[model samples]
Target chain A: MAELDLDSADGRREALRRMVTIRAFDQEAGNRFADGEIPGFVHLYIGEEAVGVGTCASLESDDYIASTHRGHGHCIAKGLDPKYMMAELYGKAEGYCNGKGGSMHIADVDAGMLGANGIVGAGPPLATGAALSIDYQDRDQVAVGFLGDGAVAQGQVHEAINLASTWDLPAIFVVENNHYGEGTPVEKQHNLDNLSDTAQAYDIPGVTVDGMDITAVAEAVAEARERARAGDGPTMVEAQTYRYRGHYEGDEEPYRDDEEVERWRDQDPIESFKDRLIERGELTQEEFDDLRAEIEASIDDAVEYAQETDAPEPSAAYEDMFVEQPPELERFANVARTDGGANGGDHR
Target chain B: MTAQAELEQETETMTVREAIRQGLREELERDEDVYLIGEDVGVFGGVLEVTGGLYEEFGEERVRDTPISEAGFMGAATGAAATGTRPVVELMFSDFMGVSMEQIMNQMAKMHYMFGGKAELPVTVRTTEGGGMGAASQHSGTVHTWIAHFPGLKAVAPGTAASAKGLTKAAIRSNDPVFVFENKMIYEQSGEVPTDEDYTVPIGEAAVEREGEDVTVVATQRLVGESLGVADSLEGDVSVEVIDPRSLYPLDTDTIVESVEKTGRLVVADESPLSYGTHAEIATRVQEEAFFSLDAPIQRVGTPDTHMPFSPPLEQEVLPGDDDVRAAIERIA
Candidate 1:
């Protein structure tokens, strides 16, 4: 590959800003979820920020992505507003799904974020479909599936890989292997040493990279996107990363020792990337401080916006059930009412 | 104009199979975004030959022949639907839905609603259902009732040649995901279809095939034919009204209720198993709406609640037939 101008000051600053925003958003959301202000289960994306930012930065807004339960970082990296995302978490009307879908189902179709699926390994097949849509529509866009190491065991993922390879679909499968599938290490769960070996079965190239290093992830994703655009087929990129926080907001680190978490945090992606940029003369300390300040301000604004947003009306539940009013809903509602009325008569 | 003149103006003759083929051909010609994808759908002309010669005409891209992986292809179809292409996936047989139920139940069915109605999955799954082909228990069975149970899906079963064409066209045009259950038995069955070439019947509506005064016969798919046969046989002694619910999910119970209100008796004929099936649902809805008008108890004629038997005699005994429908109608009348 030709030498890319990714080491520029603007590029480094943009990457840092995105990564910081993701971390801030995840932390804030985690706190809110713990306080009982947010509805539904949430999986924080605190430590895996670099992987999302680096991969998404290589593509355009027209490109597509299917995310996992731990999807806040992917949503931020793909350019979705944090205010609406937070509102969604709060189960307020201002949320992306109008409060119908909470944290696990957050989505903005206009931003090309298909959804943060509740089912494990469900994103791959949906991403494959999105890639097929792009190819069928005759566009040069590609679809990315962001999955975790735990999702590798799902049969749907293998089915998706086979389809993508056979049809030569414009798809990129990114596995953010955090070494643990909620506590069980990958070594104990599967027969293979690396998840990338699974990609070889589908006749696609697989690459492993340093998930903590945003630069390395960016290079891998850029190459995969290029190959997809050229109609070469799908690629699998595994990023070996870690999570600083527990899977959910209140999970105790009983399964793993605190020392392991501390070890991974010491090599934080944002700090490491910052050091590399300064060492290479790509960005100065003053510029980095300004970028950090800007990101903090953005996070503050998003929190304020979410806090002030109005809650959805109870009647809103009936809305968006279908594109048009389905007769089944009316019939079901009528049955409920009739059964209630017959039992109560005139009690009220 | 008189009602007779209007009927003459709207009627033409064709086979149910040709009507379906014409529906696909017309839609493909009308919309560039519409395409077909399934196993052996392109070159092999489909296993049942419902999609014959479409591959040669539309070429490889539009009429695609996929590998024998239902889960993979169905997922791709779901993705295509979300991204803007209106894909019609041929599942070949309704029994094959078991292999790709995740795509149908979890992904495609829930995406639009889960995304806060930001998306529309305008995909149609055309599959052959109902038993008559003697292909044994595995291949021949009516699973339309099973699909109708899902909230996000629209289940459609067309009984006539004209309805087969019109409803197929409407299903393709619908913004919601539609399951078009084409009975294997009705493909070769002939009737009067419109020659105008652009005719279509809207979903969520029922059609009254025969109007009478004594008993209302509610039927779907091939059972519509059996109901009509029984209706004809009982014309002199018992006045029977046959009502075909073309689309089951968004059921036009109002029409069925109206017929029952007039006739004051009801008999539901279905091909699925008796337990918690379409017949049970239709009966419940009708009783809710027109309970006072009923002169006799609401009756359902369907197969026994068991795995479809392979033995011809056992299958015959379990499946609801002309005799069972007639018995229900007679008891109600």
Candidate 2:
């Protein structure tokens, strides 16, 4: 319920910082993965940062959020420690999931981050349940599931929205229609042009936002949040965004032409937002440079921290499977301890 | 009030449906945080009538009727569980578990472990199992085996009215995710159930329905009653020890193993498919624990790896009954 007015200088500055920071973190992650410094397939949120940042800006810190594979921006926007997130991507012990969850599954439950799920259409139900929890507990906070356009066609998404609508739960569904789902374009994957239209099935208001414009996305999210808190049920916000990177770091991207990527790149949210901030005199050229430099330094610090952090002990894998580890698991744990860990345990 | 009158009130005979309904009512009244959420669970009093009269008593907020969105609501229950509220959800039919298996398997089963044991998924999923009502393959599946076999989930399929009430209460209170598979055919089956507020059949424990020394009949759900009837009919010919393993996941192998050790023979009767099922698990565990005590080859009574056919004749043909249990006991005896 707190204010996040981008019209204000402080709000605009904060938005710029988030966008710049996301760009820095993702670009670095992509580069490091190529350099073999970070393991696993990295889904860079280079261009779609505005959607996550702007949407999250409308949410309270206590509100819950579920994210997708391309989720670093969401995690950062939700106020998760970038150091831990970088450490997780680096497969270090200090990561949010204690290094058990890599890039695709980083979660901070205490911070109300349900998780960044690897499975498509998996988050909406979780967010819906969270909203149900809030309703049950009589809490004012809302839960948001930030899914990609690809997940729009998933049957569970329909079920989740329907449940939220029927229960009048305080949930929001944000579909980042980033022109493509994995290698295939959204147009090819979906029959409808606007993913928001799918909300009609749930009888909730659905809006399409210019994802390149932070203010528009923020406004839509703010409105949805208001509706949720007012017990008006769920709303769907479709952020028409574009991703600059491939689905993964090393993707060949054979499904699309370079021209299409270039066209989207020209409307890069961070750059466009920065230009608007400058024109409004809220951000000067030197201030923009300072913001970029500040974000870059912070990202460098996170990278260094991740590099220096230790990988989890091999035996830690045996833990966290149950609240009270069953006797069978205890036997396995004992063996793990005695055998100096399992196959490839010594390696990250 | 005299002690006998009060005791009679506590020991009033009720059907499995009434017992389960009582359990829900007691739990609902016991905890404000606990509520029911499922399709037609609220206003319709549940399609099976298991949750009959709960909506009128608790009102809409507690007795929520969900859209036909199992995955959504199941996941929502998981989410609600992780947060704070204890949600008693219904899947309507065990056969349709496939529709929500993603949530049931991944989110419900793995969340606590995946969340590094920070979460307590106090969610009770009640669904009807078994076939006899001519509902066919899509509606009538004794699929408790899948849940019982799945790690991190506590599965219970109660037989008698007492267990129906006890297990439901236990599941509502357990910190872990508990799947209660109710056989639709036994809703009318009557037994004396304890009306005591504190009564709860512990998870992972088995109850010996009848004591005998010739052979141990480890049955689950509806099979327990059928097996008990089998034991009654063959009283002069065979001495069958019927043990209902109320909870399946953290299976009370000790009870079954001890019973097999005493009887020196075993017949695992479950409504699920015969191959690689609850029967197999029970049989295997008993063999492992009491192999030397066995006097004969272990027999399993279950559906012969076929779906519950639509017609009454076909369903009866596939469905395991007292005769099958008696036959198994006759061989073991």
Note the chain A TM-score of all models in turn.
0.92, 0.95
lDDT of 2 by residue, B1-333 (tens): 111232354677999999999999999999999999999998899989999999999999999988888888898998888888999998899888999999888788876766556667899999999999999899999899898878788889999898899899999998889999999999999998887998888877788888888989988888989998888888877888899888887777778877888999999999999988888887776666677788999998999999999989999999999889888888868
lDDT tens readout by residue for model 2, A1-348: 543557678877887788888889999999889999988788999999889889988888899998888889999888877889999999888888777778888888888888888888999999999999999889979999889999998989888988899878899999999988898989899899788998898899999999988888999999999999999999999999999889999999999889999999898898898898789877789988987998899999999999999998987887776554444465436445645432212232
Top-scoring candidate (TM-score):
1
Clashes of 2: 0
Best by lDDT: 2
DockQ of 2: 0.35
| Reference-based lDDT, each prediction | 0.84, 0.87
True contacts kept of 1: 0.65
When candidate 1 is compared with the true two-chain complex, its DockQ is: 0.52
Q: What docking grade does candidate 1 earn? A: medium
Worst window of 10 by summed lDDT in candidate 1 chain A: A339-348
Question: Which digits, one per residue and each the tens of the lDDT, describe model 1 over residues A1-348?
Answer: 212235576766777878888998988888777777777778999889889998988877789999998999999988888889888887778889988788898998888998998887888888998998899888979999988999898887888888899989999999999987877888877888788888889999999999998888889999999999899999999999998888777878687898889899988999898888899887788878887787777777777777788988865665666686785665455446645542222332
